[model samples]
Target: MKNPCVAHRGWSSRAPENTMAAIRLALADPLIEWIEIDVHLSKDHVPMVIHDYTLRRTTDGKGDVKKKTAAELAALDAGNWFSQKYQGEHIPTLAQVIKESVGHCKLNIELKTDGIRYPLIEQKVLECIQAYQAESEVVITSFHEGTLYRMKRLCSQIRTGIIIDGWRNSLPKELKELGADFLSISYSKLNKERVELLKNAGIQIMAWTINEKRAIRKIAALDPELLICTNYPERWHELRAESMELEVVNRKK
Candidate 1:
């Protein structure tokens, strides 16, 4: 099967990351199968889809995102920073994303609980997934091992991935014990030996934030099960097509 192309934060190259506009753009593209979104809890513990813990980078607000209520966050201008073309886009809640994404595409929701821990985030996210009946089409991921453990304990049926920035010898063993479905890692950390180790351990591999052609091509050569790219999913699509063409030629030769 061709490796799936996961949009980093929707088609965030054009729209504001984590907004509904970005999700819609990614859904419109046939090449993208998985839409990766970051989620944080609002003051009221509503799961809001966004990347940073702070709102300054993506929104017109000036404080920690957790400090704002969902209603307050809804009023912020989330699009103007990227482009005026999307001037009024607002951050979307995880429930809204799940509802909108139903029958459209799968979601890779990365719980943003690394630096700022949000109590019961796992429960809130799982509740959203269950409410939408999207367990078949959702994969929950996080850098927090405890969060992943909580998710698995809450719902073993829910597919889970652990996002790691660096290599660890105990990662495969840990994932196995945690009942993780995959390993989401930085593109630079993938090597032949690591890929073999992961594959041997029955773990799926996903590489992230790859945009440049060279980096994308290099990671593609590793043939990860999923390529999480920002700005240029089309490039990944092109490279995959080219790789398939080469495979066909080699078989005939």
Candidate 2:
């Protein structure tokens, strides 16, 4: 099967990250099979699409996002910081994201919990995915192994990915117990030896935040099952073609 190419945090290169515009742009691209997004609950327990715990980085507002209601978050200008063209984009809810990309692109929801709220996060995320009937296309990912464990019990059918920021040999064992389908880790955390080690263990590996072309080529040579990149989805067609051609030539032997 052709390896899946997921847009890290949506088509973040063109639009504000985690906003509806970024997601819409990602879906419009034919190369991306999945678009990854981050989720955090608002003060009222509504799931909103965002990457950070604080709104100061991505929006006009300045405070903990969890402390703000959906209405307060909506009133902030999420786009102005990126550029003036996107002057009024509001923070999107998880429901809105799922509804818009239901059939257009697969969803990779990364749970960003500020507290020990795994149960609520799992329930709310699954509820949203189920409401949109996006179970087959949605994959839940988290840096926390506990969250992955909680998610598996809630919905066995949904695929789960474990996020790692550091190197560890014991990850495969943990992933197996959690029933994780994939491993999503930072690009710096990957090496040729590590890639082969995980691949041999029947785990899919995906590296994140890789925007440089040379880095992409090097990682492509290592042959990960998926590449969750921030700025390279547009070039996926080219990269995939090169990889496939190499595979074909090698198969002739």
Best by TM-score: 1
Q: How do the residues 33-148 of candidate 2 rate in per-residue lDDT, one tens digit apiece?
A: 88889999888888899999899999999988888998898899999899999999999999999998888888879999633853488888899999989999888888887888
lDDT of 2 at 89: 95
Candidate 1, residues 1-253, lDDT tens digits: the string is: 2678888889887788889998998999877888999999999999999899999999999899899999999999999999999999998999999998988899989999963489779999999999989998988889988898889889989989899899988999999888996888988888888888888898878888899877887776675564555567777777778888998999999
Cα TM-score per model: 0.93, 0.89
The C-alpha lDDT values of all candidates are 0.87, 0.83
TM-score result, candidate 1: 0.93
Give the clashing residue pairs of candidate 2, or none: none
Provide the global lDDT of candidate 1 against the true structure: 0.87
Candidate 2 Cα misplacement greater than 4 A, ranges: 1-3, 114-119, 237-253
Error of 1 at 181 (Å): 1.8
